[model samples]
Each structure stands twice: as C-alpha cells, then as structure tokens.
Target: MEELDFFKSPDEFPPRRGGYGLVHVDCVGKRGYTNSALVNLYAKLGLHRYNWLEGTNFELDSIMKFNMRGAASPYYITLVACLPSSGLQQIFQVLVEEERLGILDLTCPISRPQGTESSKKESTPFLRPHSEPVSATHQDRLLGWTKSVIPWPSSEIGFSDTKRFYMLNESELQCDWISLYVELAICTSHRWFKARDLSNFELEIVQVAIESLHDKEPPSLKSKAAVIYIAYKDLAKARTGEPYHYQAVVRRVINEATGTLSIQGDCWIAAAATA
Candidate 1:
C-alpha cells in the first residue's frame, strides 16, 4: 500500500491475519503472500537474476499473483511473468532470501512451471534449459578460500565444537559488493559518522572469522545463534586518513521455524597509535 525499501525491520511487522485471497494450488504449494509491493519487487528480483544468468530478457509484465511458503526469508515463490517481446506468460519458481542488512538474494531455478510436460510443449522458442545444480559447485566456482594463517596454540586450535570464534579465510571480501554490505553495517544507527567524524572509511579487510556457541560470545553478539567477525584495517580520511584496526561484529538472527534471517552490526573502533 505504501513505498517499501529494504530498511524495514521484518521482525517489527505486525502479523497479518490472512492473505489477500486464497489462490488455487495447482503445482506450487504455499500460502498466498499479501504484500503487493513485495509481489512486484520479488518477482522483478527473480526475473532480474534469471535474465542475468540465462542471458534472456523475459520482461516482467504485471504482478499477477504470488505465493510464499516456508514462512521465512529464503521464500520459494511462484509468480506469472510475461515477455514484453512476445506477451507470452509463464510460471516460474524463484528463491528469495532477505538478508539482515536489508539486501535480497533472489535466484531462479531452471524449470518450466505448471506441469513440465505440458509447459515444455506449449512454451515457444525455449532457451533449451541449460540447467546445472548451483549448490553442487557454488563454493568451488564463485568463492575462494585461503584458510586463516593465524596460528593459535594447539590447545586453542579450535573450540571443542565450532561454538567459538573459528578462523575463516573466506576470501569473498575482494568483491566490491560484499565490501558495501560491511560499509552499510558500519553505520548502525551510531552517531560516530555524524558531523564528519569518521567519514571516508577505507577498509582493507584482513580476516573473516565466525563464532558460534552463544555462551562464549559477547552479550550483544549472543543475541544470534552465530556471528561473523570482520577484521580489517580502516582509514578515517575525514580525519588525517590515519589507519585504525577494528573488528566489526555482525550478528545474524534466524527464525528457525520460518528460516527467516535478520542481521545487525556493531564495532569498537580505536585509532592506531601515532606514527
């Protein structure tokens, strides 16, 4: 009904009693999603990702209908989309994950909706459906890992379980977008960046480690089941461009029942000693 942005806190939303209306359950199974705003946004996101990966422009025509299942963030959605080029509407299943930082990770799988047999025969000028399991080699192809070189004592090698801060050398930090997520996290409603206090943050991310097992983590970080610790060297150019080392603590809250995710960030910044 109103303009929507990624900034809204999902947890704060007052629960709706029912969906817009009960739609027919043909093949895709899920409760109807009432948010018309999200209906357009999520559908576009799904199509955007699909077009990017498949190199096909099956333009979004209108938000016909939407259904959300799993009751959480990474929702499996089925919607109708038509190609502006041909006005042929097709059903597609999309996976959309709402991140804590208000970012979305939407993906489209390779499948023809509404009975693959019939749709395959009816749908015209197909893309040949070059499908591959993304999860099968997702890490091997896109992500690179180095394994943290931080040498801890053998006794402190790792927690009895992965319940404590374990070294993570996940090198996804080199990308500009991942760096942007960290940048947004640094502005966590704190006044530190106001009045030109700590602007021009140039970060050289040094390490990415994760900690679990709530009991051993900080009280604030313990709010979530797991934590991602981003260690980096920063330059506050608004000042003297002086370098400072800080570890920003990122907390992710996941609703296990619905598999929805919410994230918050915090950091304790201390300047590097005078050179």
Candidate 2:
C-alpha cells in the first residue's frame, strides 16, 4: 500500500552546527499556509496508504491547517486532511527524507497526530481502519512469478497461503491497493532528482509483478517486500514519452515482528531500485 519531514521552524529556535531544530511556522488562519501542490500530493499519498491498510475508504476532501519544519530533504509535515465521505477530518504528521522521488517517513501518518484538537477530531480516521483479523501475511504478495500482482487478496485475510504466488480475478483489481501500486509505480520509477527534463513527462506502468520471501511460518531471509514494476517514461505528456519498459523493484517497510498490517515506514516509499 502507498503511505507517507524536517524543516526549520520559522517560529522556533535557531539552528546549531550539525543539528536539526523543531520549527513552528505561523499560519495566516485556520487554513494555515499549506496550499502548495507538493503538500497536497503528500496529503493524498498518506491517505492512500491509510485506506489500504485500515480497509477503509477515506477520500481527501481538502487540506486544513498544517505546520512544517525542515530545510530541504527531510521535512516534518503535520497536516489535517478533510474526508469527503464525512465532513470531518483527520490530522496526520510525517517526516520525509528521500532525494529523488520520495515519500514521508516510514513512522509517519502516525495513527494520531500531536495536538489532536482539530475542528473534526478523528472523525475521518475514527470511522475507518476496519481490517479483519489476520493469521499473518500480505494481502498483496510482493513475490514474483506472475506478470501481474493482485493489489489485494479476496479470500485470504493474510498471505499465509502455502503457494508462492496466487492469481487474482479481474474484479479484485479495483481496490485501494491498486491505486497505491500505481502511485508507487510512477513515483518509484522516476528517482532521478538531477534529471530536470523528466518531471513534465507522463508515466505508465505494465507487467507489474512482485517478489518476496516473507510468506511462510517464520519465513526465510528478510529482503524487504519488493515490487517488479515495468514503467513507460513518456517525454511528452501526450502518452508518447518513449514507452521504455524496465523493471522497477520497490518495497514498503513494515514491522513484521509485531505483525502490524499497516505500512509502517520504520519510517514511506521504503526501498526503490532499477533492475
């Protein structure tokens, strides 16, 4: 599933040598100063991750107030997201630390954010996160052997099936996991921060597959859950950026020892590499 920083505080203390200082930015009003497109992207991405893991469908309606503090790389963003399903909203905070294409800290989208005194308490999140009890395993298998990987499993609560790979029905591909995968497929494929020309181009993914060793009882080695995604980089947003297909192996960091179903970023966008 897709999930979700640091910046200096405009309202806080001064920075020291080799040190990061917590920031407190002053907002104009209840809406805060978080109207940037990138900030909006982060809010949506975090909600996407939350939906899959919690088994709830909370769409982002709008962004309320937010506080940020960081220089460039790892930015700590605390934002309140309004859900369309319910007028209420949920407050989320995260840490971002990736160079090329990045997501928030693995430990982010913190179930509850600090100072939860929003106009809409936990109305958005409180009504969601309804995952059924699972014995163990991932609903979406990251292990490869197939040309496509079903975003979520229908029958099994967990991916504890003895078989290494399982097939998914066409109907089952319409879950939040698919959105998470697609979002990941696009972002993870473009990890070149220095490549300035690639930003405006569009992206497409196909032959998506996954490979993992975390299935069995006690499983095998820990190689981090990986998805072998084939993406097309179109230099033109007209869907003709040279459909160069290559494998994009990506992973999400979760705490296996505790058996938590959510995409815990031990800190988002856990691992990315080209093969």
Candidate 3:
C-alpha cells in the first residue's frame, strides 16, 4: 500500500460490494479529525488493543447534517460505516473482546424516555452474552463510567439521510460515533509511522536493540514494517522528564530464535506538531 496521508479525506476509500456491510450513524457536532490525531490515539492504544482488521478498516461512508422537521432546525451529523460482512463480524467479535476486558454492556441504550417503564427497572440487559442482566450500579462500575469515562457502545434503531446520498433509505443499518471513535478509534490503514522518518535518537535505539537481538536489521525492516511508530502524549503521568509531549514512529523487530516479539525496535520522533 502507498504511504497513507491522514490529512486527506477519510471518505476516499474503495467501494463495498455487499449492500452496506455494517452502517453506523450518530448525531455529532463538527469535530473534524486529522490523520495525526488518529495516529496519536492509535499509538497510545497500540495495535494489540486496536487490532488493524477488527477496528481500523471500518470506512467513513458519509457525514450528513439534517434539519429537524418540526422543531427549530438544529442540525446533527450522521456517520456511516461500509465494511464487508466479515469485517462486520470482526467488529462484533472485538466488542466481545472488550467485554472480556470487563466492560460488559456493549449495546446498552444511552437513555430511555422519561417515565418509561424500562427506566424504572434496576437492571439493564447486557448484549454480548445475550439476555444476561446486571444491576445498573454494578454495570456502571465494571465499565468504568465513573472513573475513566470510556465510551461504551449503545445502539439505536432508525436514522434519516434526507439528501438521499448513497441511495440510503430509512431501513438501513449503521453504527454511531461511539462505535467509530471510542470503540474503534476511526482508522484506515494500519501503518502508523515510517522508520525512514525516524530521528537519529530513535534510530540509535532500534540499531542497538537489533544488534543485541539478531546482530543485524531484518530484511523486511525497510519494506514490510517500516511505519509502526510510538508516541508519548500524557507526560504528567510519567515518572520523570520535562513533561513535554513527544511522538515517534518506531520499528519493532523480533528474532524468532530469541522467542521475543519486540526484542529489537526503533523509533523516529515525529517532525510534525506533537499536540
């Protein structure tokens, strides 16, 4: 694949053959995202947490703003996902993985109407295991809403595409903003950073690690896996340093003989804006 330019429109992607593999729409304000912003987020999480296939391939189909019909015209964004059926399955499986990580309610409803009977109930149905009920308080605790404020997936039915773009109608399926940014981190290609762009400091680290592990850089280091980068953003949490934000695109190498996956690695400080 050619080097990805995250600054370009994310909507520019290949077409899906199967009818709207998995569509997700959410009402959102205009919060434009850049390629570097997503790269920063991905570096923080790493590929293991945000699996390239399970999380990043979901494409942004469209972002539409529609006026409320009756009330004063307040506009909101509708984000669409167009992935292959297998991709859709992978997304759900990732949700199951998150649940295994202890957030149980992947498909919880954000809120019900005031005075709804379900709102009066003490428990909310967890979706992954299907039909398992947990107390609302415990559910909130396990999901870390009070502590970390991580966005959990909550689904709703029915959305409108007033402009008729993509020939979409009222009956189609779509995931929402939480599914895009919070659940998946809205990614495209998996290559995070190119090692050729590494700063001298970062290159030195890679070279030393490689010499210690394999006595040389792997043949595929330049071509196959050059862009796997690392970035450090939250410095106040760090034990030492001046606490300035810094980022690097790193190359991680493994010597199967050593039985270690990251025995050798290198990084390049991003020459771009760190914020």
Error of 2 at 141 (Å): 17
lDDT of 2 by residue, 136-158 (tens): 45532233312223233333443
For candidate 1, lDDT tens digit of each residue in 1-275?
53321122333344556632223222233333244334444455556545544556665554433334333344345667777787788876554554322222222222234333322222232334433212221111111211122222244463344445555445555633334336545543331343133234577887665564245443222233445666676665425754476656554433322222334454545333332
Error of 1 at 67 (Å): 23
**TM-score computed on alpha carbons, candidate 1:** 0.34
Q: Which candidate do you rate higher for lDDT, 1 or 3?
A: 1
TM-score of each: 0.34, 0.48, 0.21
Model-by-model lDDT, in order?
0.43, 0.38, 0.23
- For model 2, the local distance difference test gives 0.38
Candidate 3 local lDDT, 15-107, one digit each (tens): 446532222222244444222232222222222222221235444333332111111111112223345455442211111112221211122
Which has the better lDDT: candidate 2, or candidate 3? 2
Output the lDDT of residue 136, model 2.
40
Worst 10 residues of 2 by lDDT: 264-273
Candidate ordering by lDDT (highest first): 1, 2, 3
Looking at model 1, the pairs that clash are 100-263, 163-212
Note the clash tally of each candidate: 2, 27, 10
Who wins the TM-score comparison? 2
TM-score leaderboard ranking:
2, 1, 3
